[model samples]
Target chain A: MFDSKQFEKDAAEIMARYDQKKAATLPLLHLVQEKIGYIPPEGEQWVSEKVGVAIVHIREVVSFYTMFRTKAIGKHHIQVCTNLPCVLRGAEQVMAYLKERLGIDAGQTTPDGKFTLSSVECLCACEIAPMCQVNDRYIGPLDRAAVDKLLQDCV
Target chain B: MASEMVLSKRLKNPGGAWFDAYVADGGYAAAKKVLTAMTPAQVIDEINKANLRGLGGAGFPTGKKWSFIPKDSPKPKYLVVNADEGEPGTFKDRYLLERDPHALIEGMLIAAYSIGCHKAYVYIRGEYIEPYRRFVRAIEEARKKGWIGEAVQGKWDWEVTVHRGAGAYICGEETALLSSLEGGKGFPRLKPPFPAISGLFASPTIVNNVETLCCVPPIIRNGAEWFAKIGTPKQGGTRLFSLSGHVEKPGLYEAPVSVTLRQLIEQQGGGVRGGKKLKAVVPGGISAKILTAAEIDVAMDFDSLTAAGTMAGSAGVIVMDESTCMVKALLTAAKFFAHESCGQCSPCREGPGRLYKIIQRVAAGQGRRQDLDVLLAVAGNMEGKTICVFADAAAWPIQSYIRKFRSEFEHHVETGTCELGHAYAHH
Candidate 1:
């Protein structure tokens, strides 16, 4: 199901940007994760060979960064920022609201596998406090109206 | 006000101006002038005279940092832009990157030419998807116009690469950023071999913050003296202060370094929300020591803030009103440091978690009088003992919050409840 040939072409292009091949490990891991929804063991091995780094080092990078997830999340991943700034502006209440609305806790996915909620740290969108990243988009200053709209759209 | 705005002037345009619109506004004129007329030494001299310091919290002089790069280095030099805006209360770089991205590119052009750097990398955080896309688009536009590629302006070969960081706050550190850039864990390296000397691929590398780089073009365009005269004698130019939390109008405000915390909060921020009485303010990002309401008269610069017992870290002004609970506030801050600690150094790795647990117990109304002393002792032990200053930063909130708000913390421990809430209910 996965297209290896096209991946090799794209991986090579990414590797060419840096002088050393190891620098491309993050980009390559990102590409693989985007394609497969998660970095499988094979994905790690592929990046290891492509970037010429050992598997252990690849695992280190994957584990170190909070964004890199080994398992697949739900169809929609909702990351609520609970850092100080966001917390200052009632992020705890917002998280509670989302949890109640979705019938799930902070680190859990819905029964239908449609939504995954995560409590994250400062996304640097403190200007729009009480914000979250729904997939790749930033939705924030989340009031009752915004949460309702988000729920309607998610369904 | 229009003329005074340097970095944020172009942010008035909603999605930012395209390359054509940016060029129309005399965007690349400084870079062109630097490449055609001025020598690298002259450019560096101008920056040195301007006194522009790093806006990414360190307050290091930009020109001094550039001058550190060895001119005779056999290996190729690099210019890595620290767009990793991870500080809790700081969001100024996000605006600079998303809006007026060309400013950063043009600034990078001048910087790379001044440092004889042919390659540049912008390490943006993984969370800033929109800003990252907007920045990459700006880079492509510049490259397509031959402003950032091989033989830029028909002068020298250069290229700019955009690298996205996976979420790690420690990666905001220069050496940790270097390690992350090299595709390793975001653990910081020892300092003797600074990045300027033995950096990226063991070559001379200069890592400048996004806002710091965005200040470069203006410094070259206007003479150094004009830029220098705008702010304090030691640190020149305006800063993008991120005013957040309980402010009435929470947004980015460009102010001279001489601007006071009182002016920024009362005047620019439209005073605190709902006309509430101000209780405290984090004059910098979360890391800086907290300032009481009485201390709001101090200026919002590196030197002035340090004199006031706080650093103007990233120029993020977080205002808090009287209704807030200090114990709960410290708990939130402690939780952040605990979660974000990279676990490399023992003090930073272990210290923050302990602070969070202790604060959590105090907030839960199950704390002893001895808990306060233990918190102070643990925080004291964490400071100045780690490989990086993260331990110091984590310790600051514990030390400052307890020291400043001792009575409130004592009330929480003795009565197992917040006095602020009790006072409010009674009133």
Candidate 2:
């Protein structure tokens, strides 16, 4: 389901950055995910072929990292930092607010498929505690007002 | 004594991340000096004299680590900057990356030169998008200015690439980082084939933390003795302590290694939040043993914290107040370790999850009297029995929390409900 020529070209460039082809597995998976939105079974096979490693090996990498999404996600993926630092700074309340407002528990997507809320470990942004990463952007010390604003923008 | 801000000197500059601003503040001068004038051995000697330690977590002596790279190796020597700042409560590397990207780049240049490396990589955490972009731009600026890449400043050829890590806390481990760099699951390799002996494409490699490398340029410029005199006798230079949780002022503070936990918490952190009494403190990262409020008078250096039966690991310094429940706190820590175990080794894979499950049960107000001893025994088994210290790190919080707050745990068991209410009640 992916563009083979484009994938091969990008994979070549990434592989060239490393001494060994095996080292490009994570980057290749990321590239595929960026392009395809999620890592398909076919995409994993393609990365395996490109990196010259076994498909199972690529699958191992894909499944190991929390960032790699195997299934399709919502338009906006809200990753709340629920680790210790954020927890201490009222992340539990922030998480509760999101769950109640969104009407979905952690790791669940909205029925409209507009939002997927997941509680993540430290995003290493404890400076702004009780934070959440909405897609590529980090929104923090999240209150009802901030989360409401975020939902408004997403909608 | 007031905590001196050394590494964070240029952090407040409006245009700090820009190449021109860094140059104006004498950024690349040390890299240039090391490349043109100083011998590789001389650079190593200066760093050794400075006594800088890895600021990532371990606090291994920096110059001594560089000295381990085999001089006669036929393979290309690589200097890997561990910018994957994943340790909970630690955010100093993020500051260094975002505010002073040039400093880290310059530090990398000097480190690469000392170890005779032509190529280096900064493996930054995937979540740090802004820091990654800043670093990438800084590298481009350095290249254009003739500071790095292809016979830099007409002295030596050095190149740096910023590699982004997929989300995995285990990648913070040096060997696991190399494995991740090689595009594998972030599983740590066996040591003795340590990074120095056989690392990254089977070459002799030197992996240094981002903050540790940032200390290099200043040491080179001012000489090792000046850097040495910054802190204590053995531990030299200022460290970035990421003070968060229960603190009035929760942010990154650059203080000397001699700075006590009390100084960091009271003086820099503005004491506990809402004028509450301090309950406990994770002196370092989540991995370090929790120090009770009274025990926080100890210095935050590596040896002192170790002497206090904890570590100055990653210098995270997560503060907890009296309102916090020990059971819930330990549960949070246990959950983090459980989620990030890598599952490569049996003990680490199984131990963390079991600890989390047991802690979860106890936190939920369902605990056997025997559960406490069971938790301790499981944690003890996990320690010193894995491919990497991740198992040991996971075991630490379990052992320390139980030992320090046995009464709190007993309360959970007896009352059939948590006194602090269910923090993880939603989960």
Candidate 3:
């Protein structure tokens, strides 16, 4: 039901490390997502068969790590830190500003496919509170002004 | 020419927001050294030669772990900084995040190049708002200067993103960290496909401790031989050991691996607070075996600590003075483990709760002597039976405490009260 070429290769590699193939589910999820930019729905069964685990086990692993994106993302994925530290440090206002600035809420993709904005839990750089991550780079400690400057740079 | 170990690179700035100050003090210069001069292989070779280990509890070899990433892989690779500093008695990562944010950025860049990764993530703890803000500004500074992002200074295209973790201690695990970075619940996964080949966004990934990754540029710039010569034969370079609790100087200190615990306490931490007699020390965070004053002479390296039946986990030296009770100390540590259990495995979930209840019973003056055996037996069975070492972490202290301080536990039960033989107030 899916293209198993990349998933098969990754599953084989990750599973080889373990005595049980079933244990490869988590690693496979990570590998598949990295290879394809995101995990397609059909990649689940491909992984389960390769790792010898049930499809349900694969789902549990996928559902567990939020990084395993079910759908495709824009070229740039903007995840704003909305957890307590960031929230306390005005991460909420940053999200609102981004929403107004981008004309999209936290979890929506812009029509241009350049940015997908989402309010994520925390970015762990609490000392640099009110931060947002664009793809693999961080842009932050924003009030309305700094976030706007970041958005301008992104666009 | 001779060099010496000076314990704790943390106070290098000594306090306040000084990004420019860190740069002026030969900080990012090391990173620029690697970025502008060395090739990826040279960096990796130097790290491998130094024999540095991750300070974040797990003690994995830093260079070897990075080398495990498949260089010729057909996928986009990543380097993630595991800055989720949730381990109790551990406040060192926070200082690095706040004080030397640029150092981490430099280290991340070096690590990213060595592992053939242009993309990197700094996975930090959720509660570190102030630290996160500081890092965000620092990262912006680096990016604007073109030290990071899309072929800076005629180098390769690079990306360093900051990813935050929610308020869950379990995310400190590498696998759980990757999960949290991907925007999922902070639950740890069974390892083996280890973060090396399979990590962050799934590509060939290298998940390194913040402190561990921070050591890379220096090793790369100074050469492996220079780096290796700083510490003991096997353990190399300086470490930022967070010294808190009853210490007079109670702050982060940087010394090489050969620095003895006594020197660290006396010279760095300024000895126990208010001249309080040193009773016991939780050498490395809450999980390590507690050491009494006699053992204070031991050095603070990975091997020496292991020989002493504990680890220098995250180098957070938590000192306990005479007034602290053993039961209370063990309980404080146990309560953290119990509360932080991710509810994934039963041995850790039920086991920690049971251990907590058993210890609580003994503390509340409702103990039988056999309860000590019960605690040991339960803790013994729980070890090595979970998806993560959290089980072993939860069990190790109980087993060690009961073995070393069995008298105190027995005394509490016999007297039907705290063994310190004093009236206890609910903390």
Candidate 4:
């Protein structure tokens, strides 16, 4: 499954930075996710072999973290901060708006596979409360208009 | 009184994150002074005299933490900067990383020199992509200026690598941070082999908070007595208090340790939002016990808040106004703990999840009369029984919210709905 020589070379560089091979699990998984958009079963097997760890252990690490997705996701991942601070500042209303806009509930992807909505705990951006992360960008203090504009821009 | 702004002095400056701007504002002068003139013991002594405590929730003294490193150990010592500011309602470290990245870099250099560490890793949270990029840029700038790479300043050898955390709140715990740094799950390790002795990569490591390290540069530049005199005698120096939720001006405020909660809410935070009456305050992060409206007159320092039955944990001041429902609030807090628990221990794993369910039921207007006592009992069992204080932190909001707002909880049970409606339950 691991055919790319460049991918193997990059994985080796990540392993060389750490003292133990087990320590390269997260970085390697992140690299795979970055390269392939999501961790497929083949990617997991690739990581298990690359890190020289058990496949089950690699799966456990992958499943434990929220960022690592086992399945394929939509083109855009919309993570709304629904933790306490955001909740106090009307995160629910924001989530409701996103649900209506996307025609999907939390943790569900749109039928078109355009956007996946998930409520997350504190993105540590409480200064601009009621915030959400659309892919790598942290956009905040969202209202109906802002979320609409965000959705429009996502396309 | 005007709040002192030592760490946040450059917050409002345009282009403050840039290396040249930071240098123009006297950024690495302290670092150069420490490396060129001061000994490791002298640097530690100055910080100890300043009485600066850890700003990452715990109030442990900074210099004493650095001193814990075994001087005679053969292993390459490590200094890990805990930039994983995951505590809810706390956002000060984000400001430090974004606005004043050079300050933290300078502080990291001083800390590395003090602990005899050649290589340091800044384990920043993955979510903080902007701050992470800003920090990495600052490090590169410093490298070009001959401040950070390979025999830093032509006298001592020091290098810094910025590592990103996947997504785990428990990694804010020092040992758990080390575990995550080694590319594993964020699980708290057993003590007696604390980070100072057996930390990242099985070496004597010192994990200091980003804000705690930022304070080091100032303490080295100015005399320790100057930093000591800024705050109370014991706590020493100003701190970044992140004020959010129900306040008119909800943002980060750098204040002295002697600043009262009332002053923070009214003076700094511009009072409650929409002219509403204050209902309650989580004086620190969610881990510290909630404070009633009547109790917010107390000082916000570590010792003062502790004496007032709360703590100065992370200084995350979360204010709630009169329209907020206590039961729903507790439910929100419970859900956070439930989700963030590393789950290595049974109590933390099961306790928060169960507590969250009970609170969820109670908030959804399906509560039993005995449920209140059950909440307290579950919280009691969870405290002090886990590998780390995560369970204890989870239990605190349960115990304190119930104790302080018993009537609000009773109202939820009797009315079969929240006083503030089910707005919080939409998620």
Which ten residues in a row are the worst by lDDT in model 4 chain A?
A1-10
Query: lDDT scores for all predictions?
Result: 0.89, 0.89, 0.73, 0.89
Worst 10 residues of 2 chain B by lDDT: B1-10
Measured over all alpha carbons after superposition, the RMSD of each candidate to the real structure, in angstroms, is 2.3, 1.4, 11.9, 1.5
Per-residue lDDT tens digits for candidate 4, residues B1-427, read 3545688779877477898888888889999899889899999999999999998979999999999999999999999999999999999999999899999989999999999999898989888889888888888888898888787877888877788888989999998988888867888899979889989889999999999999998888888998999888789988899999999998999999999999999999999999999999999988889999999889887899999999999999999999988888888899999999999999898999999998888888888899999999999999889899999999999999999999889988787777677543646
Off by over 4 Å in 4: A1-3, B1-3, B423-426
lDDT tens string, model 1, B1-427? 5577777778878655579888888899999999889999999999999999999999999999999999888999999999999988999999888888999999998999999999999999998889999989988899899898777777967898899999999999999999999999999889969889998888899999999999899888888998898899999989999989998888899989999999999989999999999999998899999999999999887999999998999898888999889888888888889988899989888889998888888888889889999999999999999878888999998999999999999999999988777221100
Interface RMSD of each: 4.0, 1.0, 10.5, 1.3
Q: Candidate 1, A75: how far from true, in Å?
A: 1.2
lDDT of 3 by residue, B240-325 (tens): 77765677766666777788999988888888878989877778876787788889899898889999999888676777777766
Query: Candidate 2: which stretches are off by over 4 Å?
Result: A6-9, B1-3, B422-426
Residue-wise C-alpha lDDT for candidate 3, range A59-129, written one tens digit per residue: 76676545667888888788886543344345556777778888887778999888899766444444345
The sequence of per-residue lDDT tens digits that candidate 2 reaches over residues A1-155 is 56767667877877787777787788788888888889999999998988889999888889899999899998899999999999988898888999999999999999999999998999988978989999888888788898899999998
For residue B366, model 1's alpha carbon misses the true position, in angstroms, by 0.7
TM per prediction: 0.98, 0.98, 0.72, 0.97
List model 2 lDDT by residue over B257-276, tens digit each.
99899999999999999999
Whole-model lDDT for model 2 versus the true structure?
0.89
